[model samples]
Target: MLRIKKLDIFVLKSFLLLFCGTFFICLFIFMMQFLWRYVDELVGKGLDMNVLAQFFFYSGLTLIPISLPLAILLAALMTFGNFGERYELLSMKAAGIPLLRIMASVVIFSIFLGGMSFFFQNVIGPKAQKQLWTLLVSMKQKSPEVDIPEGVFYSDIEGYNIYVKKKDKDTGMLKDVLIYNFSDGFENAHIVWAEEGKLELTADKQHLYLHLYNGEQFENLKSQSVISQNVPYRRETFKEKHTLIKFDSEFNMVDGSFLDRRSDIKNMREISVAIDSLIAYGDSVGRAMHAETMQLTYKPAQLSSSDSIKLQKEHITVVNVDSVYNSMTSAEKLKTVTATKNRLSSLASDWNMKSYITQNTDSDIRSHQSDWHKKITLSLACVIFFFIGAPLGAIIRKGGLGMPVVISIIIFLIYYIVDSGATRIAKSGGMNIILGTWMSTIVLAPLGAFFTYKSNKDSAVFNADMYIMFFRKLFGIRISRHMFKKEVIIHNPTYKEDWEVLEDICNSCEQYARTHRLLGLPNYIQIFTNNKHDDVIKDINQKMENTIEDLSNTKDHIILNYMNNYPFLSTTAHKSLFDNRWLNLLVGIVIPAGLLVYLHIWRYRIRLDKDLKTIIKTSRDIQEQIKNQHLY
Candidate 1:
């Protein structure tokens, strides 16, 4: 058992607060998206308060798996980012706490959260989905509220089309109404035209009552005679008329068990059972089909006793189809050919249908398997995203919703796109369902690990200056001089001593350049083997630093500029012409062995040559300046 320290408690408290806030925020966003997708089923149903409440409750539950991982990512990012931004992380590091140690509490908490997420997915998620969909189905089945719009045909009522030219909102009266009633049958439809009408739902909400004033009803009458060409019709004029239409506006819940058979609504055990059952069923069906096909193609003939006796007396003979066809009449040949074509066509159609059904069943099985893997993969995503987010936050050192939100959304979108694409491929049986479902995890986990490793080392992973310097070195670009504020120095009488020190430094650089043989293949081999050159460079850098400290009070800008060039000289020595044995080895092992390696080595040599020349020329110029200023 591990004991929690105060620091751990502090870190966890901050993380928990952010996690809770982000979790609810994510959940609400996901719930809104869910509502948008199913709004059609939910809207205008006049659902009861209890029904609506249950829907929202289940919807939130169902969205937990999706929202939880995103929340963890954002919260972890924000928490660590704030620490880094405020230099709290630096203080913790200075206290001898490693990044991993600082993260241990949150890592443990993330694991616990992942476990809970799994539980929710396996247990609560299915129940919520079942209930939510049950309510949705009920809502879809419930009739819409009666609000007839003017200048449009209203067909919400079954088997009837109602049109209102104008409606009075205050009086609840429809003006210039036209009703086409086809509930009895299309041939017996009744068309009613009314100057005004009032529509009301029955007390039980089972039917609609329409009372019309100054209305005319036209009904098509059915003919008793089958041969009757003209149909009889009836027209009735009424001062006021009332009619009842069958409409069930009551909310009715469907059975939740209807969706139980879906794989998404099952736990791991249930999913395994379903996968096994599906595989076994598929194999059995394939075997049965194969056996049936074999039976059809080469079925054993049943012989009677007389036929067997005849066959025993005579040898069996083979018939040649071509010779038999040649001997047949033209009409007979045509008939035989047509029969064969029709038979082949019928068999092909039957086999095609069977293949289609098999393909569809296999696709469905893959989809279910993918969903089964998704249950575990999504839970695992929480831990993976936490690792990624925490390390990334430390690297970026940005807090608040601005930068963190942008980065989190971008990463989540990438994960979603990859997961979705792989899922589609798995559903089509183009890839293994397990592999497809875990593709994003496989890709992102290594990235998280890399970020963790870098963060632990306090690497400048996101530092633009580091990458810029790298590119500059790779391209053999000249190092830029560092800028300093212009200032006047009072003392400058040590010019002769400075010249001797600069000459010594130049002699040391020239001697290293000559002794290392930096221009040839020996330089390449030296990169792989450690030599005294690195130590020599370090000594020279220390000497340069001491000399610069001695000349700190120099007033000469020329000497100051030459001193500034010391950093460039040190950099050239630090990144010697030949270094990084692994890179050399890799380049050597490639197909064109040493082609790229040779180019790089040449670039380094050229850069070193230029840096040495600049160092020598700048030292000579400083000496000339000292002599010209009569400082000796």
Candidate 2:
């Protein structure tokens, strides 16, 4: 937990970066619709910058709730990804920290952030939405000049297309009116043509009046009386001939828990408490059963009518036989009857036990019970995903937008699709919500654990060295230990042969090469064998030692070259290279300042070589001793 606290700064930074990135991306996409809807209405009205800014700020807050969770998930992926990519995670592991412990901080951060998001969704979001819509309505109605267009037909403002054929320069009166009303459904929908019309403003300027001198309204009235009358009106009044344009569209309010409207904060708290209790109980039960199932069965001793009748029939048959055997000796008859009764009782008991076993194995009860059980399983998905992303970052040991982005997308997509489908099924009341949401996690949790375990145990499952080996197998390429140059053997006498030592050396060299690559060092060195028959154990060890030394020299030389060349470049080019070199240098410094901080690392390695030499000498000496003993 202290370690988790220590990582707060890093976790917070990652969360903020991810949150901002997602928010901006969402803003850019949604802003166009937002601006398009209001831009025309605010053009000539002299809209305040403060109002627009406030609108956007409130809108942004509403958007943050949905965006934050996605951002957190992506951020976690990228953070661990960077750690893995940079080998910082590997370094942590090498220092004796487990991957799960390292992820403790991220999990804590996500939970806290998730809680914040839930709050935002419930409280700030509703207020922001209400304010945004109210402001848009206020801005639209106050200014008529805002909705009027000079040339184009403004149909988008309302359902009718208002066209001005001619206009007065002084009064701004639109003449030769043509109004196309498309709102009243087809056929009844009609176009109004007027010989002369003028635009006038009401006393409040809140309403615009269209005054007509002479106009004929075209309509297909189905009533015979309306068709026969043929009425034509040419009248104009102050308020009678005005269209009250209501630009305000009703907006829905987001009010309550994410899952349910009736769900209050208190209800959520209760639900959380209940969930915790249920999870604890279910987990204990599941462990006891050694399964995730939650069903149990027992049989009552009460017999059904059919069973009673069958027993009665068997008894009556025995009684009838006894009645028929009245003349038989009493002792002999009693003994026969007792033996028969014991056999019948034993058979009935066996059948009852079998029926009880069958009744207890019912899956309907299990499925119904598992519905709630599924929720507990699903609740742990977020934690399991952390398990996957964290250690994977450590294993892949490369984190940047490139790999992290790709991996995050794949993982999140899989999670989202499964979660969504399951939720939909659960909501329709067909399946359990918990099971639906958690099915993806349950399937993937073990897979992630397997990868983490393999990584911790230093398994070569995802190790890049395997690729080289795979390629060699596919291409049938072989490199012999003898073909590679052999170093001079240093002599000593205490060394002894341990065949198992070969596997240990191979694993070490593989790990060393991986660490070197992560540190941005040159060529990885590891043994590649096409044959297991011949032992090249000593040869592989010698080559690995030489390669590691070479890797160090190669990195030092590259650093030296960059440092020397940086002083002699042109201004613009120099700036570009300088920026890149500085980043690289900062990254490179980790290898020496961090990995090589212990002088004993070098000393211990040197001791390994001396021990190997001693083992060789001791083996030769032992062989000589054995030969002399045989001669004696």
Candidate 3:
């Protein structure tokens, strides 16, 4: 028996409440997307409330599998994010509860959700899918309600186009209606003019009834069979007219037996059976094609029936194809080549046709296999996404809908694109079904593991300052130096001695610049492979620091201010590219990669060269200042 921990209950309650809210939100979003795809079918058909209700109900059910993974991701992110932001995560860790232990409840819940997703897709999804699409086709087949506008010809009605000069919305009455009837044929068309008219559906809603007051009907009296010298027409004037037109206004639900849902409407057992049948059929086709191709042999027409029959029954000496071709006359050679080309072409075409049959068979098998694997993959996606989101949330330390929403969308989109692309590739036989369907999950699982490891270890995975400092140290980047005037004179300036130290820094800078040829570009090969620290530059930097320290205590403002011009130096700017021999050798061998490193090193070399000049000039200026202050 498992004992219920308060921690587990708290975690489950927190995650589930958010999970339910997120699930509905995600489901509604997916349903809206689903509705948008068929909005054209549903709109203007004047479908009843029950039909619309059923549309959402069935569609929402079908979309549950799609929504579960994303919902789990968002919920996990938000839950852990809230804990991190509120400092609850910190307190829990401080209490010795590990991150994985804290996440244990949610992890189990996500697994359950994943299992539920599989069951829902395998069972409930198929029924909902059939009903939803069936309703969609029925809605698409339904005719739109009549809404003839003023001054416009409505051609929606079959065999007739009606233009109304004016329509009264309150009474559904039309004024100055003109109807063109092309029911019989466009050549023998009829026309009607009405001062006022009203159109209504009949009792069975299978016909349209029209009542027109003060109407005139004109129609061609001559039929297409008759060839009269003068084309004659008939005209009739009446005070009132009643006409019936064939039009169906009732909604009829259709049988969706025509729909192709062989794979989609199947459980694992049914799919396995379908897969087996398809595989067997494919094998039969392959064997038949193989037997057919094996029978094809090039036989010369010049050979007699007896010779051909004899050759077919017995083994013959191996004939040199080259020698045989060379012995043939020009005309015979042409005939032989043409016949061979024709035979090969015929074989190629037949092979292509058979190949297509087998290819399509394989594609069908892949589709079924993909569908079979999708249930398990999507279930696993829920668990994988939870791992991803929960750990990432802990890392980002952001709560509420703001950060979590953006992050969830980005991650979910990545998953969706990879999954969809891989599944398509698999279905098209570009890759194996199992690998393709599981690719996205495989891609994300390691990321979740990394995040979990980082979060559990309390690593600053997202700290910008930490990374910046690391890169700076790695590259030997120089930082800006800040120095200020001190009010208290705990130590007075040794100005004469400091001036001597400045001279020494200047001499060392000139000597190092001369030895290293700092103004010249470095060898491309030597940049990575032979990189070394400049000990002389390090010595020069120490002398400059000593001089700056002494001048910093000067009472004279000019003398003290002059020391601010001292350069903040980096010791290893010209050192090994990666601090490793193997990496340095690897980089040196790659020219394009090596070129970039060379440029970076050269830029630092130029800076060092310029720094040497500044050192000499600044040291002399400070020496002059000390001489004027006479502080020694």
Best by TM-score: 1
Q: Write the candidate numbers in order of decreasing lDDT.
A: 3, 1, 2
- Deviation in Å, model 3, residue 252 alpha carbon: 2.0
Error of 1 at 389 (Å): 2.5
Which should have the higher TM-score, number 1 or number 3? 1
TM-score of decoy 1: 0.84
TM-score, model 3 to reference? 0.80
Residue pairs whose backbone atoms clash in candidate 3: none
Ranking by TM-score: 1, 3, 2
Q: Cα lDDT of model 3 overall?
A: 0.85
Model 3 segments beyond 4 Å from truth? 1-3, 182-189, 220-231, 260-262, 284-360, 466-479, 484-511, 521-533, 539-564, 578-599, 613-632
lDDT, residue 452, model 2? 70
What tens-digit string does per-residue lDDT give for candidate 3 at 398-515?
9789989999999999999999999999889889899998899889989888888898898888888899999987666657655667888798877767778878888888888888
Q: Tens digits of per-residue lDDT for model 2 on 379-438?
A: 455456556665666666665667766776687678768767775676555776556656
Q: Residue 606 in model 2: shift from native, Å?
A: 48
TM-score of each: 0.84, 0.44, 0.80
Which pairs of residues collide in model 1? none
